[model samples]
Target chain A: MSEESDETLLKRLAAGEERAARFLLARYLPRVLALAQRMLGSRSEAEDVAQEVFLRIWKQAARWQPGGARFSTWVHRVTSNLCIDRLRVRKSAPLEDAALIADPAPGAESRVAEAEQSARVAAALQSLPERQRLALILVHYQELGNRETAEIMDCTVEAVEALLTRARKGLKDLLLKDAAFDAPVKAVSGERQ
Target chain B: MSAAGLDEQRLSELLAAYGADAARWPEEEAGALAGHPDLKSKIAKERALDEMLNAFKVEAPDAALSARILAARPGREMRHGTGVWRALMSALWPEGPVWVPMGTCAAALLFGLYIGASGALTAMSSDPQTETALLSLAMADSVLEENWDE
Candidate 1:
């Protein structure tokens, strides 16, 4: 039933109930995918990460004991750790390989501008140190409370707050610089016109 | 300056971390910073950044992705049976052919029926040599005495 808790669903899942797995996938797959997508910035990689995350969950369901970390928190923690590991691997990848992960295509003129802005924001987010990026993503994008974000990150609440402060400041500076550069280009085009 | 009595420095920290939305702030701190004329400009700045961050919207996962993830679950095949007997069979022996267990049960039943119908136990008990062999196996001593009086 829709009212069933995650723990109950997991117990059913351990008993090999297909419906429970479907329910869990319906509830968490999108959120998990979004978290992975935001962290990895590549849809394919995000999908791989999501697959691994669910695989872990399926394996863990049989052994999962209640009264420990909440299921959602554990999911977030798993996703965060996997993303961080992938990011570490990406760090060793070639720069040209990094450019191969393309952004989504733009449609209309306004859409193009919006897509570019979104790309810039995503790039700024990726540029942040992993912890700061994760902290921001968990709290800002994932809409988790600071306490939960702290739990996911395995840090103190104060540490999460500090990471977020730096993350926001860093993101702001990057976007502001981008806007400043765009201004000069617009001014130059105006002068030519 | 606010209802919660938050100082300017603390308010700035909250704004930088949680942005302009009071809903996102801690319960004790939410709405305490709103409507403060002095903090309006500060809130406006954080709001601008939040708007930029909000632009990076991730699309929902496609059906193919969900299918792939679902396929990775363990014991997926075990969930397919609807019949109680079929489920019991699968639980009893998850792998190999169904005929394997069926044949085993059939062999056991036939052997049991054969033993019952043949009166094998009574025949074995009446034979003196069989009894003597059985008693020797059961007893620790090898010495046997013949009953000449019988």
Candidate 2:
């Protein structure tokens, strides 16, 4: 049914329904891919991680317990865990995977300033400890609630708040290092008006 | 309960800790700073940080990725088994490289053989008394050997 819920679709998927699988892929793939790309900073690795995640979903669909957790939350937790594991591996074997950071900037050099800014931010983001980066990505980018993020990170809501504070401060310090604090938010707000 | 709100100091702390997004600020303190002109300047600073954070974006995945992943789904049928077999299969045959199953199978076979062979060897070499009453027989034999020397 067009109105079918994720839990219903999962039940159908467990029954080996191809259409159910397609529905899920269409529904969640982009979000998962974005999450992976943001976390890993590499398109190829992100795709690999996304594919692995779905494959796991397919295998585990049959045993999925619906009410225990929302399917989206479960999917996010899996994606985060996979990304973290890959990051840890890359940390230990830096030489082998160190070349993945050369993410191609979209559009041409006409937007050189914007491209440089994005690159600087991405680099600073990548420089954060995995947990801190994860905290920012989950709350700021992914827009997950503190409760959901705490569940994903296996920490308390207070801990998530603390993480957010630390991550925001860390990013601000890094951005400030480049002398990019040209003006405060008020100036930007005035300009926006 | 007189609709009290956060003062400048508390407002700045909230902004610094939660960024400029009032939506993310603690609900109780969120409206506390509302309509307060004094904190507007501080709120703007927080929004600046949020904008800086928003500058980074992830590129959309290529369309082909969905197709590729869908195509690679495990074949249609999922087999069920006895509880022990299911646990064993899931652990040893987790979905991964084709080689993992082979490696685990080989390891499990080797382990099984080692245990089986060692058990058979023990059974073969064990004296009847040792097999039937190992602790008592060993202790009695040790005492007998010591008494013989006496």
Candidate 3:
């Protein structure tokens, strides 16, 4: 079957199509898992957040309307809010443990180098104020524009831009200071150049 | 590349755009690279940094991880209907269903009518004196006994 749009699948599910439910779950589940994993860091917690996000999707899908907001955008808002709430419970789950950011998948030899970079990014992110970190993440990885990012962050566009300015500088300082960042991207580049 | 410093605002703008998609470049901003020798070098440096950040995509959690996470879904982790309202009235309410105060109001009205009727009936069934008093009170046309003639 051609992949159903989120709106269509939601409408079908509302109309009592069980198959639509499964299809909906299968499609967005992976990415939501990744997002949760990024926020929670543990495979276990990410899994938990993933399930919660979908089950919410299951309950709410029927009420979803097209053109209200993009499904991807909605998911980011929902999942990101949940993550932030989870962070605030002071759950003793350190953002530090789950703190590492991920880059594109790299070859085996460069994996160690990438891990180090992830670690630095995580630390830098931790050093930022919560709002700033949230603002940065929404824009950086979530790919939300300033307007949407501001909405999610509950701030103005000017505030988001200001936060982004500081956040970029922070990331710059973090990366430049990391010893691992001095290493080359490809396996061969470090030794050759 | 020259030793000129990057203007902080413009440089941050480029980085923000680059973070979303490394290939994206704002026209006039990147176009400024040609005219300003200083900006030309900073542009190259910024592009390099953007590329470096893009190099590490976190491995998407494996399929098994997805399954595991999906299974472990948080929020109401307990078996369904553990909440106060859910525990008290889960079977009562369903999604999108509108509940009127219908049932409660019916029970209440029934109770009120029963009390009023029972009280009236008790007055009817009472001893003769009470019945006479009620009868006199309810009687709109009854004539009073002639005490003035005496």
- fnat, candidate 2? 0.50
DockQ of each candidate, alpha-carbon based: 0.25, 0.20, 0.07
Candidate 1 Cα deviation (angstroms), residue A31:
1.1
Better of 1 and 2 by lDDT: 1
* Candidate 1: tens digits of C-alpha lDDT, residues B32-93: 78557887766777888888999887778889887777767766555444578666776775
Ranking by lDDT: 1, 2, 3
Which ten residues in a row are the worst by lDDT in model 3 chain B? B93-102
- Give per-model CA RMSD: 16.9, 22.9, 19.7
lDDT of 1 by residue, A1-193 (tens): 2679999999988877666887888898888988987788787888899999999999999999999999999999999999989988887985322222425767778798778777777777766777888888888888998888888988898998888887877777766544422211111011100
Residue A113 local lDDT, model 2? 69
> How many angstroms is residue A154 displaced in model 3 relative to the true structure, after the best TM-score fit?
2.8
Q: What fraction of the true interface does each of the listed models get right, in terms of native contacts kept?
A: 0.61, 0.50, 0.14
Over A1-193, each residue of candidate 2 has an lDDT whose tens digit, in order, gives 3568998888888876667888888888888887887778777888999999999999888898866988888889999999999987886765323223625655876776666666677776776677877877887888777788889988987777777766676776767544434433221011100
Please, what are the lDDT tens digits per residue for candidate 3 over residues B106-136? 8899999999999988877799977776777
Which residue pairs clash in candidate 3? A47-B69, A102-B58, A103-B56, A103-B57, A103-B58, A104-B56, A104-B57
